[model samples]
Target: MIDFDYLKREIKKEKVTSFLVYQKGNSIFEYYKNNKQLEKLHKINSCTKSVLSILVGIALEKKYLTSIHLPVYSFFTELFKEQMDSRKLDITIYHLLTMTDGLDFPEFGEWNSFAPMVYHPNIMKFVLERPILHPVGTHMNYNSGCSHILSAILQKVTNMKTEEFANKYLFKPLGIHEFYWYEDKMKINKGADGLVLKATDMIKIGQLILQQGVYANKRIVSEDWIKTSTAPYFKTYDSIGFYGMHWWVNKLDEKNDFNYENTYYFALGFGGQYIVILPKEEMVIVITSEIYENSLLPLKIIQKNILI
Candidate 1:
């Protein structure tokens, strides 16, 4: 029961580059005003973290890493000096996934903010050298550093680049072959931002989550990880409901694009990139825009016009 006219109007009003709605394994609506945009790959900002989250699941499934609770420092012992904060020793993969790693990461933590190391010769030092800003697991700081550390862990454990791992375990299986990742000077996947994907590939991830780690009749990711990643494990400092792994979640506002009393969790990025999944409705919404805005406008359109 999508209001197509309403959707078109809103996309025009907001100048959204792409809007895709998928339900029950089908794309019900897709709109792009310009032909060039339709063919161009869009940058999905922080949503890269969520995609890494999926890779973690795949890594865990294949036993590249033992458990999420394992201490991250153990995997990268060379990164740490002989003397460091004892509390830092407590940091774990769970903390990284939840953005609770407690490094004093500021907004835009990845661009050029790291201390003495900078992103020049070694990006890993830039991330690993960060001082512990908060206690482990007490609060959420919305960190890209944490995700990068997880990426480092994946690479160290699997002995393969994160993109290679993803290509094997995630993208190839999902039938996604075309994409590029933002790499640091060290050629490591940024694992936080600068992932370019086609609109269809973006929604493919949404559909994968909606199907609980299954795609094309094959198990792509672990169901246990998917369920645990989507469950509201901890509340965010912002008004955004709970954050599970790298996903933002909130309760169903029945008045919104969802008529049923169900919850929705989405992978959001800067400048209005989103992959929102309304689990109860079997609906997956992909929105890409150039607004440099927050989450309100696209959310409103989905709530107001496309819920039922």
Candidate 2:
């Protein structure tokens, strides 16, 4: 059972804008400081990468792309030249999905830098032109530039804008209609950030994953994709836990006060937005917050109040 009173107190303390708990096919609890904010769109920062991962799965199911193993250069042939570093040609869709493209793009550690690519006029070129600092697919570097490259690849293969494809295959099917997706100057949806969705919509996304890519008896994406995408492929930052395709996986071995062990995966965004899927508990926890400096605060609150 969840301690709602304690949860509310903690949430209020953290200044979380919205909080939701869905379990066993029902939203067991919901809290919004301002009820009107329930339907308001909130920026879901890096969670956009998880959504793009879904779109990529759909594209694969539809045969728009043959395989994730396919070299990214095949899709973005125009971006490459004969004189370019041949190693860049080795980067695959899998590399981008896993954030191991190793393009010398740093977004974490003392090298907390993303403004260069974000502000560049030709963002795709800016990302691709970066020096390959590590061997492709061997090291996991937290890089949003790699996520943006995946968006560009999706657009190139689908022959439609990433947003259009998402609307057709993902959003509309999941009953998500009111939302906003920001695109780069090249018109590719920002796969790393800039997706605005309501807290309820965020819950829907979590539910979709919780239900193994099914929603309302409809198979929105393959179960294989769900398992594959959420499977932990690498250990990320201490706070972020393990990294999957574009998702974050965590396992809490030590039982909480209730003596319940927990293993879950989540879609995390900058500024405290999260869509946490707990398959064992059959629950989905959605949180959107304004705490920009401490994006993990919501997760900590959830752990203290619910997971414990």
Candidate 3:
């Protein structure tokens, strides 16, 4: 068994609310503090993007999305009120998924200053108006606007909202019945943030990824999609190492397939929400916190204790 007493002390020292661990198909450890409920439906923040990653996989398999290679603006041609940049047309769904859209969005984090683009009547338009700062596929920038456009793409292709399509396809199959994905005024679900799910359900997401996109013996998404999504497609400039579709990958050490590597690929949120999957260790860790700033504390815990 793991040491929850020490972890509880660390969690008490911080504003962390929930911590759950699953290994070998069992929930081996769990902890809560700050009067956090076991079934609390708190927003996972940008961790929501990773969920959208899974939905993209499902959409691909179901043919809701024609191809990640398709140009992003192709789906929303009717919404543009002004002439658009030719550079923007070069962006593809893969660029959005990988956050290489090169959109010069000043907005970084929610805690950052809100500009006109955010509060504008239409978010998709706001996102599109941002100047292309770099050549598409040549730079890596973390922008939520790309995620929102992706959500909009889901709506355009599926003719259903992001959350609705996810519920019908991704969430429902995994027995995730209780969850809420907040939307903007235009009824477009915030794809980059605003998904509220219980800690258990969040772990189920990690579990699904750990299980190769299968849940309860059912193939919710293809195993090939899981591999493709988690593969190290691009290496970020930061220490996060490589980025896969939307998943962060750490292929630092590998010996054999099952028992050799200590690598863990995870979904990270703005605050501290995480769904860390260690394929070698056979472990999945989910953490939710209120500490929006310096969210590295969770990663510290995972590194110093869990992964060690």
Candidate 4:
């Protein structure tokens, strides 16, 4: 049996604001440093990208987006009309979804790497203008700009802001209210980060994915999309595991294959925010924290204390 009291002590030492473990539709363990945090909308950071991935699947199912293979230029015709690079036209929705767009905008490996694109006068233009360093769709680089462009694409095709589209379809169905999604100067929702949500609401999202896009007996997105989006498309960083559309697949046991049923996958954020789903164990884990640097610390704590 897992030691809840020991886990709470470990989490508290690590400065985690919230921690919860849900097994078979029940919260077996929960911890919050402050009771007020239960009501607060904490910033989830890059976990927003995973949420945007779900929105993309929903849009496809709704027929707002026909296919992931469609070239991004098809959505933003005006943006690419004057573009010089022929390769940019080849970048598709699938590339953006998988973070294999080959864009040069780097989010990691440098201090404040994401700031340059976020602070640009026109975020979409900044992303589009970046030269393609790697062959499109072949390499997987962690780029926030790709996700932002996705948000822009969503806005273009759906004729609604990303926040509005999510509210009407995703959030409402999951009963996720009292949330905030920040937008750039262009007023496009930040798909890469800047989403704030309650920790409990995070659990609902994990549960939704756990049920294969179903929530409360309602089909929010198709099961096929969930399986497709969460599959290990590319081998990611050694420490980070695999990358699916925007979700992450991690093999806790080295011997195990990266299958949906065997391994755990998660939506991770920069500052220790996480929604970890272990399908084989029939469990979901939610953790939100304030540690900005050394973000992986919380995961280590979880593995040592809970996942063991």
lDDT of 2 by residue, 170-259 (tens): 999989999898998888888899788988998889999988899999999999999899888888687778899999988766333211
> Please, what are the lDDT tens digits per residue for candidate 3 over residues 1-308?
45778877877788788888888879888888745568789789888988999999989999988789998868887654363678888899999988888888655435262335457788888788888899999877777888888998998889999999999998889899999989888889988886999989998899999999998999899898888888776775455556778888775354433222755789988678899999877889999988876767787887767776
lDDT for predicted candidate 1 compared with the true structure: 0.81
RMSD of each: 3.3, 2.6, 2.7, 1.3
Name the best candidate (by lDDT): 4
TM-score list, all predictions = 0.90, 0.95, 0.92, 0.97
Error of 2 at 90 (Å): 0.7
lDDT of each: 0.81, 0.86, 0.82, 0.89
Clashing pairs in 4: none
Better of 1 and 2 by TM-score: 2
- Which is the winner by lDDT between candidate 2 and candidate 3? 2
Evaluated at residue 8, the lDDT of candidate 3 is 75
Better of 1 and 4 by TM-score: 4
| Residues 114-182, model 1: lDDT tens digits | 223334477667666678888998878777778778887888899999999998989999888899987
By lDDT, the candidates rank as 4, 2, 3, 1
Best by TM-score: 4
Off by over 4 Å in 3: 34-36, 106-117, 252-262
lDDT, candidate 4, 1-308, per-residue tens: 78898888788787799998999989999899899987889899999999999999999999999999999998888889878988999999999999898877657666353447877878888888889889999999888888998999999999999999999999999999889999999899999996899999999999999999999999999999999999888885778888999999878778877665567789999889999988988899999998887788888887887676
The global Cα lDDT (0 to 1) of model 4 is 0.89
- Find the 10 residues in a row with the least total lDDT in model 2: 253-262
